[model samples]
Target chain A: MDFGDSPEESEFRLRLRGWLQGNNPGLPTSSTDDDYWKGAAAWHRSLFGAGFFGMSWPTAIGGQGLPSVYDVIVDEELAASGAPPRPSLGYLVQGILEHGNEDIQARFLPGIISGRERWCQGFSEPDAGSDLASLRTRADRQGDDYVITGHKVWTSYSDDAEWCLVLARTDQEVAKHRGISAFVVPMHQPGIEQRPLRMINGMTKEFGEVAFNEARVPAVNMIGGPGEGWRLAMTIVSHEREPGELGYVARYTKVVNELTRRVRVNPSGFREDQVRDLGWAIVEVEMLRLHVRRRLSDRLNGISHGPEGSVDKLLMTWTEQSLGHAALSIGGIAHGGGDDTALNTYLYSRAQSVMGGTSQIQRNLVAGRILGLPSS
Target chain B: MDVRLSTEQQALRESVARVVDQLAPHAVGEIGNAERTSKLDAAVASSGWRELRLGDDQGDPLATGVEAGIIAEEFGRGLADVSFLGPTMAAELRRLAGAAQSESAETVAFTSDLSSIAIAADGQLSSFVAIDASGCSRALLLAARSDGNFLAEVDVASDEVGLDLTRPSSTLGSPASLEPSGRSISDDDLMRWTALGLSLTCADLVGIMQGAVQLSTDYASQRRQYGAPIGSFQAMQHMLADAFVMMEGSRSVTLHAAWAVDALHPRDAVGAASVAKAYCARAARDVCETAIQVHGGIGNTWECLAHVYLRRALLSSDIFGGAGNSLDRVLQHYGIGA
Candidate 1:
């Protein structure tokens, strides 16, 4: 079987890599253990201006739509170039256009594409973390606008957002999944509050809580149908976890490079086992790379993200978490004074198994859907 | 980039799922029946799946009516009892090592090893041990050594004193069947095939585990304990969720490895395959245990049939080498010390 890039894909990579050479943001290579988000937003604007972002959206709405491989290629370049992920708004808004209506597209897609507007997902109330469908938030419809009032904790980027695509209960009488509708609620309205949740990284630029009290949004801001938020959220998350093998390959390369540097320096005085551990991590990452690349090929070929996506997430979660943990163990849980790249990695990866639908949820999907296991 | 299997591959997958869902899963409950393994042989002959090996013309052994891996993966999903590895390895021998000079046999044992092939060296092969020959597959042979891989079927008839029943281990005074490496395949090629077979088997176990998890989850949800569906409890949710994630994560790696064999091939397949198998092996264990845990008391009883899946998972996991071996091989391929 041919796993290497096709000649065409090879040519695509050359062109893509060439473009990224000058346009790359060139952050620290060890950002996994460093706060490389120093100029994350400006990096976003630069990448966006280079026409590197939105490579897959229809050109009419600001995308080349050139084989979707271009998007994978670009993201690969972005990661390899050490460019931090753009704002949550950048990721989610374009995501909306892919699944949202034309009206919603025209209103918000351009602003997001140009880096003019930002967004935060208004999901996750205190009561509904993993069981997000059980969230208690409501958006009552008014004449020209809908008044939204709810308490959302751990909204990743609400404070820095111009608007939020809020998932609120529009049909409270219906069971958890049914009655929910998503709306684009403006953040400038009178009744919106955002509070930063202190983090170990202390990067207050992103991640906070959004408490909406009579926040007003245009009635036309409703996306999809009244009960389609579940579908939209699922779609967004699936896409989030399953795209870009090139990106993972790029990351693997970068990590391996870092690992090699560490081994060469030998300052930490690691033994054979530690070296083996480092090597194991590198191999695991490579293994993960192969797995994700296969998925990327499938997705680019117009294959829907199905049980295969679960495989991607599973490998990714373990690889990532393992890398962090390994880094911690080899590099020391808390290195000299205050550095804990590995520790932070370990801590953060704790969420890997838990977030974006926990490991259990993915397994349930695998067992029930992919394997055709009988569910009670 | 996409991770989805192609139409042909998808169809293969469906057929596999159908076979596993309909035939294999049912047959798994009756573990003692030797007839279960041969059932697919008839189907394979009629449907020309066996001919998929020789193909319509046998000119391009790689070019079967379908993708080569489709058959392997389908067998994996079905939990077939046949020795898939022996034939796959033997077929490689026939295709690469010339047909008439060397006779390639499908999964037969105790036929003829090192002592016999070593003395009868005619640039042809006799028998090769399917399992790790790192032991003593060739300790007694010393007359000549082939430059590359050889296909030989080892007969452990004289040495089957304490081999496990589940695994069919045997010892041999002489080689039952053998092909010397006049032009044998590379270690990488064998690894790719082994990885293909193992990854798909893991995929099959994954299927079984998937079924088990569902059965357990369903049972938990429907069966009540302490005035609530057991599934309603947070502890149960966490346990089931762990199994869910394990299965899914295992699947991603497994498919990745499978695709790697085809896509990356010569360079990356070995490492990828090991990782996939390691992940799948471990995941199968987790899935089996969690299914039992989720199933609770009923799951433990043979009458409940939960053990059917657990047994298969355990059996398949150790067949091509267990998790540790797979992991070590993966590390070795990557030049990482295990």
Candidate 2:
């Protein structure tokens, strides 16, 4: 397996790096602030204008029709430059592209591509976090619209979203998984309320508890069909589990390099145990990087996502937590005190396992589904 | 970069797996059986697998480290008592040093502290312990020297007690008054050799863990507890799943290391090898222990293969200086003081 980029990829990377050097959209101060969203939207538009937004999407859908690796190169360059994250509507777009009907695709694809609109996922509920298929959200069909009623917790960017892809029970008589359907609902409707959930790090409005109370969405907004929510949700979750089209390996490597620099600058202040821990943290990050490359290789080779994604998920959790712990250990009390970036990062790392999927849930998937081991 | 094996590499792996599977039954029943070990060693040698690292008329020279890793992994899966690695390493070293290749299987051992060695006035090596010196006719001593490095062929005087019974260990009484193989080895050559050695060990550990995970998975499916299969329990499933993760992770890193040995720069190759070895060493131990835990009482018994895997993993880890040393090597590769 060749690790070096191809000549074309190298050229694309060089061009992207040159672009990033000229156009430095500063890093976001807070994810939930209006300024951040405005800046992010402007940046997203700039990326789309430069044909960097959908590098791998089909040409029919306003993308460059390039290989997925090009997208990854763009991601790496953006991350390495410390640019704010691009709009994360890729997963939602994937679901719509794969499972949504033509009309639904026409309705949502352009807005996402042009960065004119933003979306949030409405899959998780207050009652159903990891066990998402058992959600109690109800979307009863009316004349031409379905009334959505449910509470979704940990809905990222809901406060800033113009629309949400909500999953709700459409046929309560069927099995829990088969009873649900996905719908594209307007977030600014009268019956919908978004309450910003204050995180442990005191970041407000980044993640919100969205309550849908008889919110009416046109029946045409339904993606796929009734009883297809589970499949669609799986598709979205798999995309979410990906390291992004650009990959997070470069970002993680940057963190490691920063850690090494910090340790090197204050060699005497750091304990031997901390140094060893940092060393191992570096090793873990490198392994994670390799794992991600392998996963990308599989994708490029036409291999679909499998139980191996759970392995990647597990590694991501471990590496982020380890890096944060190393940072905290080195920074000690100064980092632990409020308002420190290290403290913020360490606290945020706690959500890595709980988000995407809990580590426990990932392990279960790896054991039973991936390994084909016996299951309860 | 592609991580999947080529068609030829896949064929080689399948053939090696077949050979290992044929000998697996003997791996459990007869530990340290001289006849069994000899038969396996002879079969491997005659199969010309030992010459995999050193190309023949049919293959390219020193470009098959990946193939060697594949074979080594299969051997590890079968717990086969074959002296392929050491002999292959010796032959490669001889070729690099411009010396004649040894015909017999040669076991390579190392000592970090040269002062621990007892040399006679005649410059003959007195005594040294060779770890994992099984099924070999000669022992090659690798040690640090003032010039560059020393690699000398020695004789295995007697067998010694080793935790891994599947592979034998020995103590060398004295060398045959042979001079060092050649002059001081270059840093690049030393790095390449170390990378190859560590990659093989990593592949072996990957195989051992894979085998253990398979055994435990089978046992968990059949072994019932409280009117249900033990594997049905969340605790057992998660435990085994963690083992599977370790096994796959080790497999990924080992394959990359194998590729790096043949394709990457010497420094990068050594770094990759160090990462593979350190990760595999810890992962193998965890997988084997989890296997025993999942199997309950039977797993710990001598009749069961779990302990055998654990022993092999422990021996493999120590052979390449274990996780701590490997991590240090990694740090050193990164230009960090370790």
Measured by lDDT, the strongest candidate is 2
**CA error at residue A46 for candidate 2, angstroms:** 3.7
lDDT of candidate 2 over B31-118, digit per residue (tens): 6666766676667767788776664454234556788899889878888776666666766676556555676667665442211122
For candidate 1, lDDT tens digit of each residue in B1-338?
45556676777667755654554434335533557545644445455443333412443455431254555545544444433433443454445444432232343222132101223354232343332121123222212345654544343342422121222334444544453444455666555455555555556566656666767777876878788877766677656766766665566566666566546654566666667777777778787788787777877786665666676676556656667667667656655442
- Candidate 2 at B98: error in angstroms? 2.8
What DockQ, on C-alphas, does every prediction get?
A: 0.23, 0.58
Q: Largest TM-score belongs to which candidate? A: 2
Candidate 1: fraction of native contacts reproduced: 0.26
Worst 10-residue lDDT window, candidate 2 chain B: B112-121
Per-prediction TM-score to the true structure, in the order listed: 0.78, 0.92
**Positional deviation of residue A222's Cα in model 1 after best superposition, in angstroms:** 4.3
- What does the lDDT read for residue A291 in candidate 1? 53
